[model samples]
Each structure stands twice: as structure tokens, then as C-alpha cells.
Target: MSATAAERQFDELASLYEDVAPWPFRRDIEVPSVLHSLGDLTRSDVLDFGCGAGLSSRLLAGRGARRVVGHDASEGMLSAARQREAKEQRGIEYVSRLTPELEQRFDLVLAVCVLPYASTRSELRQMCASMARVLRPGGRLLALPLHPDHAPDPDYYAPYGLRLVSDTPHAEGGALRVELRAAGVEADVTAWYWSRNSIEEALRDAGFGPVFWADPWPPGLARVEDAPPALHAYLRRPHAAMLDCRRARVSG
Candidate 1:
């Protein structure tokens, strides 16, 4: 997880991120589990790092978060996010600058599919450090990463009898030329393939205690039901993870 690559790729694909994001339409694997893992917080200050399109930020605000500062490397996404926050009247502060503008502290830091894009260990470490720095001692951080063994192969995607193919690197999480007919849109997305172990170790190394994980989506409700038999079967098995963590204090 190298710094330069992840930032560069995110900056490149910021505009089209929302199209592939599981949003507005519907899905089971979503923010609830993420929220549940963090327990209840009424008016807690939150940070949505890599807050593309502001979906989760809006969700946090909708769920009684006092103030959610959205941070990302993509100006295009942040531009869209600002408009969205204005539309929702959510009073969210959106920042396109990652490290400098994110100097302020918060009650919680959410790293949603943000770190898997890191190309080197140092970049991944920085992402965790960013989350740690923003916390108010005893603050929480929620991070998600695709399970390595089940990581989505860039060459394969099976929809209801329609298969999507890409020459893009598998590490990108099949983001480019990404058209999901079932999901009903397209994009030049930038994503990543990462192991849960890699993600958890990074979090722990940054001084956060690991807490919880995400449940696989319920099929009857999401595209799982609509997916071809093979895909549906695969969906039932857990292929991703969400980690809940609390930043720790140094021993005196």
C-alpha cells in the first residue's frame, strides 16, 4: 500500500466512483453493520475519509452524527459531495485535501474501502495513522477490506448470464470499464483487492483494537437474488469484511 499510487488512482477515478458504489438503488451489505459496530452516538463528530459521493457521510448525519467532515483526494468527488451535502442540508464539511485539512479531531473515523487501494505498506500505514490522528482518545474507526482468498478477480464478474470482463489489473478491484448491467450503470472506477489479514494488521499496528465484522448481504433483497445461480451461491459466502476498532492510549 504505497501512498503515491493510491492517491494518484483515487484522484484519477474520483468522478465516476458513485456509479459503481452500491447506493441509492439498494443493497444488504451497507452502513447499518458499520453503524452497529460503533454502537450509538448521538451528535458525535465523525470523519468519512475517502468519502466518495458522501453516501456514508450522509448516512452518519442522518443517524444523528453532529458533524461529519468528509475527506478525499478527489476534487471531482468532493465537488459533487459538497453539492449533495447542500442538497441534503446536512451541514457537512467536505475537504479535498487529505492530510493537512484533516488535522482536526473527531469522535470517529471511517475508512470505507479506502485502504485496499494502497500499493505499499507505508501508504496503508498512513491511512490508518490518518484515522488515528483524528480521534479524541477512545474514538472509534471502522475499516472494511475485501477478504484476500475471496478477492474479486479482475477478469471475472458474472451477472444474470452476462459476464463482465476487464484487462485491468486485478489489484484495482475491477473498477475500469465497469458496467454492471444488474446494478444498472457504468464507470471508470478505481478499486483494490486486499486481504482482511493485511487490513487488520495495519489497523493494529497503528494502535487500534480490532472489534467487529460485516455480515454478507441478504439475497432476497439485493442483487444476489437476481444474480445467476453461481453468482448467488458465491454471494452467500462472506467475501468481504468490516473492522471495528477503538484508538488506544499510550501506557504511562
Candidate 2:
């Protein structure tokens, strides 16, 4: 499969992404929130868009999803994911693009950190449309995009081993340089920022029903006040936001 400029960039970071599984933010905040948002997966067919090293794909399979298909544009990332699938034999099908047979085939689509990579509003809409295209009429999509209200301070997320820097923090489609660091490992990636209105408009135009932004709260905590002091700030200003919405069901 041919790679886009963004995909090629991810190809170089494939190894670093593997190490991301152990990052405190991913382990303690992001993953937990994502899993919580995706409540039961039994007998469900899921599409892991931007599967990236198959981390979330494996998690879905392990959670009892009947079938899991991982789709990605970066061959390097897919290679790492395929290698793990070969060893684990988890029955996941990894593909670079959706085929005719796969259209409207999934019950749910999980797009982790995928939408923010869209550098343009058109690209963002196309990404959302693709997710909608693969889902059954009433199927749902769970996505994580850069939080529209993230703190402007580049070092705000340094405690979580992440740093986001942008020349125009308020620009609707500004470039964001993301740095990930942990335990002697470091990687840099580029993403774009879109406001809540822009994101929701794209979803609606893509045939999705009402969009919901879920809080990325740590699991086992009833409220943000219940979180430890160290987590209060991050919880208030997470780097990414969770979005959930369903494809508009067919009308009679």
C-alpha cells in the first residue's frame, strides 16, 4: 500500500510507538478511558482504524470481540502489528484499505488518535466518512482527537511524558508538534488541531447522529475530585478528547 506523508512519518516512529504502551498517560489515562467508553465487545465486529502496532486491536480481541480488523496506512506500523498477530494468532485481519465486502460490515469503529492527524478540514471529513462507510447503519464510532481546549502551554502535559507545541495554538487547522518521552525513549510526531464545532460538523456531515464528548477520567474514580492531586490538572486538560457517535440509522 502506498503511504501518505503522515503515514511515512509514522513509519519512522513505529518502534517508538511500541514503547508507548508503557507510558504513564497511555497506561493510566488514555487506555482506561477508551476501554471504559467501549463497554462490552462480546460477539461484536470491530474496525480498529489507525491500529498502529495493533495495540488497541489486540485489546479489542482480548476483550472478546468476535472479529477484529485493523486498518492502517503505514506499512511499518502494520508490519509490527502483523508480526505480533502471527505469533499470537488472534484472528485479526490487518488491511491498508477497506474492500467492497467490508463496506457497512462493522458494528463499531475505534479510531484512536486518528482524526487529529488530518491536516485539513477536507481530510478530516474524509476520515470520518470512511469510518461511517464501514459501519452498519446504526453502528457507532469512538474516536480520540486532540482536545480542542488543551492548555496552550507546551509543557502542560510534560508530567505525562508528552509535549505539544504549535505556532498558532488557536488556529483551526494549525500544525502541532507532539513529543513523547519516557524511560529513555523519545519520539516526535505531527498532528493538527480542530475545534469542537469543526469536528462535530464533520461527523454530522458524514451521516453520524448526535456526537458526544466523553470525559477522559481515570477508571474507578467517580469524579475528578476523587482523583489524586497529581492527576487533577491532566484530567482537567487532557491532550485528547473522546468522541462517540453512531451512524444515522436508516429511516423508513
Q: Say which candidate scores most in TM-score.
A: 2
Q: List the residue pairs that clash in candidate 2.
A: none
**TM-score for predicted model 2 compared with the true structure:** 0.96
Deviation of model 2 at 236, angstroms:
1.6
Model 2: per-residue Cα lDDT over 1-252, one tens digit each: 356686678886777877878876778788998898898999799999999899999999999999999999998889999999999999999998887889899999999999888889988898899899999999999998888999999999988788899888768999999988767778888999899999999999999999999768767888778876778789888888899999999999
Question: Alpha-carbon error at 81 in model 1, in Å?
Answer: 0.6
Worst 10 residues of 2 by lDDT: 1-10
If scored against the real structure, what TM-score would every candidate get?
A: 0.74, 0.96
lDDT of 1 by residue, 108-132 (tens): 8987767666656667777787778
